[model samples]
Every structure is written in C-alpha cells, then in structure tokens.
Target: MGAPGTARRGPVGEAEYPPLSRRSGWSEGSFSEMKYYEQGTSAERWERARTFFDAKRYSMAADILGGLVEEVPDQVGPRLLLARAYYHSAQLKRAEDQLRVLVERDPAEHYARLMLGRTLQRQGRDAEAEPHLRLASALAGDFAAL
Candidate 1:
C-alpha cells in the first residue's frame, strides 16, 4: 500500500462507489475526473463528506463540504467541517476565509476565533493572529468562570 493519505480511493471508497468511467460520458477531463466526488441525496452527501473527512481524505472532504457550506450558509456545522478539511489539506487561505466569516457572523464563537488565529499563524501573519488568539483565550476564560 501507499502512504497514509495516498490510498484515498482504495478499497473502501472504490469498492463502495466505483469511479465514473470515461464510457459514462462525463465531459470532464482526466484531472477533473479524479477530483469528482460521488453525488447523492443531501444527507447521503453529508455522510459521504464526513466519512471522507474521517478517513483523512481532506481534499475530497473539502470539495464536498465546500458546496454544502455554500448551500447552507447560515449553518455553522458544515462550514466548520469545511474549514477543518481545508486546514488539514493545507489550504490555509480558504480555511482562514471560512474561519473569518464564522468569527464575523458570531464573534463569540471562541473556536472559530481560535481557528482563525491559528490559521493566520500558519500563514505567517503573526501580528494579525495575536488579537484573535488573545480574544479566544479570554473567551475561554470567561466561559470557564461561568
């Protein structure tokens, strides 16, 4: 077998949902074909995205979750999962964008603030990360006192 994340479309995923073959007539090229995620009902897609995320297929999860987040902008759960998937996939900018939007929508969301701070830090923007990190810590402390 290959490395941990390399065997992404291996037994579990491949066996369950075989990759769309060229004969099926998708106009997408090879690169897009490889990136194509399985389509299903909303709940099924959510479960698939979660399963992919759990399996460490970060890019696959992110791809699915990104669309889900767009579909349900008011819902924080899918967005958070998308951010996490982006983060793990080394898509720091996208993760930061998602976290920033979450923090803006709900400034009291400590985890989002923390993640925003961390994402910024990961991108080497330490100066910007400081305030968010401090705010996150203060928020945690306040919650602890309650």
Candidate 2:
C-alpha cells in the first residue's frame, strides 16, 4: 500500500492523477542558461559565444567557449577565443592556463605566446613572463622589441 495521498488512482477507483511536473534538469531560472548556452548544436553555440563576445559579455562568452574548447581540445580557434574571453573578463589564472595549453600544443604560435606572457604580466609575474614575451617577439620577427 502506498502513502495515503501518493496513490495515482483515487480511493473509489475513479482514475484520478495529479499533473506531472517537468522532468528536465532545468528550472525557470536556468532556462536562459540552457537555451542560449547549453542546448544548442556546436555551430549554434559557437555563434552564440561570438555574439556574447561582441556584446562585451566576456563571462557568458567564456562559459559557452569553455564547453566548446573541451569538446574539441585539438581545435585552436575555440581555445583561443576562450582564452581571450577569460583575459577580457580578468580571469587571469584561467587565461594563463588556457594559453599555456595552447603554447604547449604549438610552441611556435606567436599569438599564444604573446597572450601567455601578457596573462602572466597581468598577474604580476614579470620574471615568468619575460621568456615567453621574448619568444613571442622572436617568433613574430620583431627582434628589436626583444
């Protein structure tokens, strides 16, 4: 016997049932999060992220790009955008982490080196940033800046 008020059918066998609640992971408050960021195809999400970035909503762009970067770690574009979003949002540690990965994956990537150096510099780690900055300058063939 179920709990008194939990039965689907009424006591008199008149087939009465309560209306079902939504069986989704999302609630009303999270609907926009799901709709704009989580529930789209890769292309749609990428476009959404770009839109957010263009709107200067860096954190929202980062949230979407973070997932895209994770899904295709080998792809440089999403990771670069994710890192840029982090940098613009003043998420220095996260920007540094993503830039480091990008640099490690492609050491000759001048942009990633430049970004990593800048990220480190923003964190007040000049000593750690020097080598990267020099390398980025060398890679870009602007040795006068080095």
The numbered model that scores best in lDDT is 2
Supply every candidate's count of residue pairs whose N, Cα or C atoms clash at under 3 angstroms. Answer: 0, 0
Residue pairs clashing in model 1 are: none
TM-score of 1: 0.71
Give the alpha carbon lDDT tens digit for every residue of 104-124 in model 1. Answer: 999999999989988999999
Give the least accurate 10-residue stretch of model 2, judged by summed lDDT: 19-28
C-alpha RMSD by candidate, in order: 10.0, 7.2
Q: For residues 1-146, could you state the per-residue lDDT of candidate 2 as single tens digits? A: 34333436667889775533355344445555564465677889889999999999999999999988988899998999999999999999999999999999999999999999999999999999999999999999998998
* Candidate 2 C-alpha error for residue 145, in Å: 0.4
lDDT of 1 at 97: 90
- Tell me the TM-score of each prediction against the true structure: 0.71, 0.76
Candidate 1: stretches off by over 4 Å: 1-36, 142-146
The local distance difference test score of each candidate is 0.82, 0.87
